[model samples]
Target: MDVVEFLSQRIAEDEAAARNLLNDRSVSESGKWYERRVLLECEAKKRLIGIVESARQAALAAMVRHPEGDTPWIPEAIEWTTLSLNALALPYVDHPDFERRWLGT
Candidate 1:
């Protein structure tokens, strides 16, 4: 497969692994272990975001290099990047400080 397709597959695999780790029951059974797992998951998610962003940038660069091509993968790259960003934001969704800062009265 081409570079964009390869990158997409890699991102999918990484996301699946992260989800598996997050859902593992062993990590949930102990308070300290759960906290550590959460931190590790957060770090994994951050790294995945960086990977997706880099892939998107590479895809954009490829499109620039081949402006006349179909460039069909751009939309997928953008969607994945946006999904990752949204996921990264989810842990903060219930934070009081975040709510106060962004949804102030």
Candidate 2:
């Protein structure tokens, strides 16, 4: 398979993993465990995975409708992805690169 299909399958697998971690009911004291750094990362990954799935669906729909080339939906998806990334990192406001990369402040 080409790179896009490979990447798409990988994303689906990762999304499944993230969702399973988030939805797991077997973990006792979920409140305490969820706050751990790794679990926090898993939460963020779950949120981003939704965005990735949506973008992939949009791209597939666009390709079906107009197979000539990439659709205009891509740029919109990219913008949403950027916003999601920034929101995910909001707690890291004090980072040195935060101002330059995000706010231009």
Tell me, by TM-score, which candidate is best.
1
Identify the leading candidate in terms of lDDT. Answer: 1
lDDT tens digits by residue: candidate 1, 12-98: 555566567667766554654555555666567657767877987887887898798788887788667655555554444454333
Residue 9 shift from truth in candidate 1, angstroms: 27
Which consecutive 10 residues in model 1 have the weakest lDDT in total?
Answer: 96-105
Quote the RMSD, in angstroms, for model 2. Answer: 9.1
The weakest ten consecutive residues by lDDT in model 2 span 1-10
- Measured by TM-score, how close is model 2 to the native structure? 0.38
Model 2 CA deviation exceeding 4 Å by range: 1-42, 46-70
Instruction: Tell me model 2's lDDT, rounded to 2 decimals.
Output: 0.54
RMSD of each: 11.0, 9.1
